[model samples]
Target: MGTINDGNTHPGATLPWGMASALPHTKDFREKANGPAYYNFGDEKIYGFGNVNLSGLGCPVAGAVPLKLSTGKFDWDIENFASTYKDEEAYAGYYKVTLEKHQLVAEMTATTRSTIYNFTPQNDDKQPINLFLDLGANTSHRKGGSLKVVSPQLITGSQLDGAFCGFQKSTNIYFALEINQPNPQVKIYENQKVTDKREVKGDKAGVVWTLDQLDQGKLEVRVGISFVSEKNALDNLRKEQGDLSFEGIHQKAIAEWNKQLQKVDIETSSNDDEQIFYTALYHSLLLPHVISDVNGEYYSREIDKVLVADDYTRYSTYSLWDTYRTLHPLLALLYPKEQRDMVVTMLEMYKEWGWLPKWELFGYDTFVMVGDPAVPVISDTYLKGITDFDTELAIEAMLATAANTKKNPTRPGISQYIEHGYIPIDDRGGDPQKFSWTNGIVWGPVSTTLEYNLADYNIAQLANVLGKNELAKEYYRRSDSYKKLYDPKTTFFRPKLKNGNWMESFNPTDRFFDIRWEGSGGKGFVEGNAWQYNFFVPHAMNDLKSLMGEEVFLSKLNDLFSNGEYDLTNEPDITYPYLFNYVKGHEKKTQQLVREKGDLHFTNTPSGIPGNDDAGTLSAWLVFSQLGFFPDAPGIPTYQLTTPKFEKATIHLDDYVYNGQTIEIIKTGENDRYFNQFTIDGKVREEVYQLSHQELVSTNELVFNTVSERLSEVKE
Candidate 1:
């Protein structure tokens, strides 16, 4: 269709050495619009969304059907011509499609590393190919340039030596199609000023040859991708293909999906939801990509201002602030082995870099967001009973990072939080700064307070569990440090002055700026203001109620839910929806809010995320809600229940259940997303929430019911 190859000067791509026999797979069994239902063969999963660009879903057209090349390649014409086959019960990562226009049979395979598409065109009018390589189809950091075309015949005869650089400047990546047979009539189509082609039959494709042809239909093109240079792309093509045809590789990829889909048996009547969930889960696991040398050596710039030996794979591009809540937790549960390895990697990173990372990017610990969320990630793993490593060493490293470093972008507020119980609206360390003028300072004090408190609570709980009483006591005391920030006068924790005087003109919602890191939303705190931050004291909810009084706490909770202001589209109020679980007789509200928030906020789109997916934050909420539970706090070993989306689902843990029991949740007649009661194996329970990881691991069957409460009765 369309061909653009700069020139052949670069060396060949290297083969991927980390290849494992562990095939790629998925638990989802639903089908979608375009491709075969879904296929996870080896390291890939394929979805068929005929013409819709679901940002980052990585549609399955790459392998089966050649990329559609056009003059203005920015727009995809596939949308006008076809629709992906949509079936609900189809298994994960496997899809079969019959093209609407050409009736071409196509199936796709998606894995962690590769995508394969197989198409059999029936009425071939010269296959009328539209293969376009839009070099700009990548992340924001990508730079496009020309690619080299090296086949067996061209590489040996011409004898070009050095690296044949790409046509466009700054084009760091390249592609080469390992074809089945040498076609005589190969010419670069629609290319201006560059029309060239050479045959390479027996010898392997090397850098000496030039890529200047658009073979529309004659030969089958094997398209392999890599982040490394073109030489490596060729190298990968050789190692992966060698003598195997493109169809051979496609078949191998399909087999990989079949194996992984066999992991968990999903038995749901609604095939559509099941398909969406499994594919969503599959896409969720695809990113935070690994960019490294062929030998798997990645760039590591630990906090020590020096390079260190990076033995374990270093993953980058995570939004930890959002992911820490649910994504990380979900990984620890479903993929424990992967989770353990990731934890080990974090520990090694801590050793190399002094502080544990909050948000680690490529070779740099870019602390983009507030919160020592690393604590929760590790602690959630430990509390959820996935402790397989050196717990003491992990804690030691965690403590060092939290204690050794005190300041970040919002250090002023964090330091004050550690020193004065609450961050003061007025400057205590020095003269008032510009940000001190804002109101967000009301919530700005939360980052360190919550971080240290959670770290302390987790470490203490872990220490006591591990028989280290002294360490436990020390951390337990540290956990209580939040008491210093609680102001009794307003019945709400407010920022204080250096001399413990309340700041003048203290309106929680009035002032806008905060001196805290990034001003959260204005200066007092992170993305949310006081209304959202008030419910953050996860362990001290009872204490918070004591200050506001039961009536006030209930009223505040009521106001938060009804006030369109408590947006579920953001992360600040994540725990707020579940606060009703803390209040006695208010469990129904918790159920209603959790389901509403879960259902309304999630959509399959580029804008699906209200905030950063942050590595799995939103996914975690889905997994927990669907399972009928969520961890309210890190160290606190309990989960609150929301209405479940499924009637029954089985969670597979490594070693928790004696043949895991089926968790069944019954929905109320009114489509209102709230719950009325919970049952342990059909017996009604007193509490409104579900079991935490600890409880779930230790307990048996769980079932839940819900009812809608009248506004009058709710107040009463």
Candidate 2:
């Protein structure tokens, strides 16, 4: 599922929340550089093994310090160094490939701090084996770097990479490589020139390790990466991989993955469906990685200093705008302690950087997406009883970010959003050539307004739970700002000028950047058209339905699927399939739509995923959908029920928070397309389509019975 065209997820080896990831590299294909380090189905020759990668991002980053192994004389031609492999395999915590050209088999696995590679020669060739450390190579734009041969068995270096989607500060990665054998000859080079000195620093600096003979059975290399310092990198290597055999590390990684995957146990008849479920679960838990070292020390790009985390494990790579919809809620159900730590980490980031992260990467705030997404993520976590952090402080941060109009990059148009109740399209002069509605600069005015309104609604929910009723009332009123953009004449949330006039000549079908003419199409939304964005009011579905009228809303909603206006590849329209639950007796359509979409988009092949994992948002949606229910609203504890894919499923809740109870969902009846009835702890539930999180975790069993008819007929 990770190798889809838009998924961009590499087949890599890493522990859950590991700082470093190891994946195969196909460097000859520069046009596909925006993709992952490895595309499982592509035929590009293997260039090297990339030690660090950002999974599922549209633009690649942090594929630094590629290590290539060969058994021939030194040649500077990178093209000649690559080898073709036939047999290849990858899973949650392991990857293996055969280098047919080199007659070698390579396998890789990782711990929290380091990745270990094992290479076995197929033939007994007397030629000397060489390991090349290409410091200049990276998936993103390289600024500069340095490499030094500290010892015969050790090489240390740092690389500076920048320009993630043309935005971000240069990230410095310090690395330490340790060879298993002692006294291997090392040579340093700079700008393609062999240097006699042990140190080399420049744009094209690299190092080569030459083993005298290849008669040995296998060779192992351990690499440790750190954002703080070289010494810390070495310490990390010793702590994670010191004297550990390659098999031992591989087993450890597998055990770790099994621990996370076993949270949800299912009884399924189809092996393909089983693989899909486990893979989706695997992808859902790979992000928001722990960035702190074993000693709780990390380098903060926001603060420009090394900081110590004494209480909690600091985490990075928060794709909050994509994750808050489903991923955070899933975490609260299965991994409450980790979710609490993540919330604490976000609070700490707010304390250090003055604002919560939007799209944080490698300790840098990229500000990649719109909205105050941290509000929804933290609010969801807090409302789900994962409140191990300071609630008052979190509320203060949310209020400050929500109310700020200037000097806050996270909330771009907060002042106008607060004052005018909507962000005007004409505020930045409606010029598509001079501006973008998707990037980080004055983009998606209407979309941002909607996102801000939803975020405010989430904050209000959290505030109400925290006993701040007055503050909650204020935020709740502000959340109704989405209504200002609704143009009753167009029957859509049309973009308006600063003078309170609708942008003329609008088309709901035109996507972002689809129309070139001035104000002809989507000038206010991000990545989607009006039809997709219209159904985005997850927090206030009843209100939206009322505004559009039930018949009009139902007609338009049905048209979204039949007319091919619905987009399943992005996050903005993911909630559309679940919206039918709000209208009574319409859930059968939801079930059919969800099942059909899931079958189309998800599979067991390399290109199984429908689109970008969006740092696991899409995967989480599938996981929750297959479970027969979904947390459609972020800050709300309720989950709207549907039809389960499996006949029976069990979700193991975090015992620390949920009193060691497990929610067992049993599907009874031959029909799996419609839900006829539901029961909790054997008590029949009539006319109720929602289950609270409290009720879910505390209950021993929740059963859904299916019938051959539609829900409306059953209700009648």
Index of the highest-TM-score prediction: 2
What is candidate 1's lDDT per residue for 379-420, written digit by digit as tens? 777776777767877888767744542433322254555566
Q: Per-candidate TM vs. native?
A: 0.69, 0.96
Q: Give the per-residue lDDT digits (tens) of candidate 2, residues 1-716.
A: 76756687778899887888888886632223444435556756788887877677666677876888777787767765699887888878899999887787999999988899988888777667888887767777654578777788888888877666557477788899988776677778888788898888886778988876632467788999888888888888889887778889889999999988999999999999999998888888888887888778998898899999998888888988899998889888988888888888888888888888888888888787688899998898888877778998899889778987667688776767877898887774335464432232546778888899889998899899988999999999999888889977777887888888899878787665532334333767777879889878788889999998887777778889989988787888897887877777677778878999999989988788988888888888999999988998888888988889999999887677887788898999768777778999999987557888888888989898887644335211
lDDT, residue 481, model 2: 82
lDDT score, candidate 1: 0.47
Instruction: State the displacement of the C-alpha of residue 126, model 1, in Å, after optimal TM-score superposition.
Output: 6.8
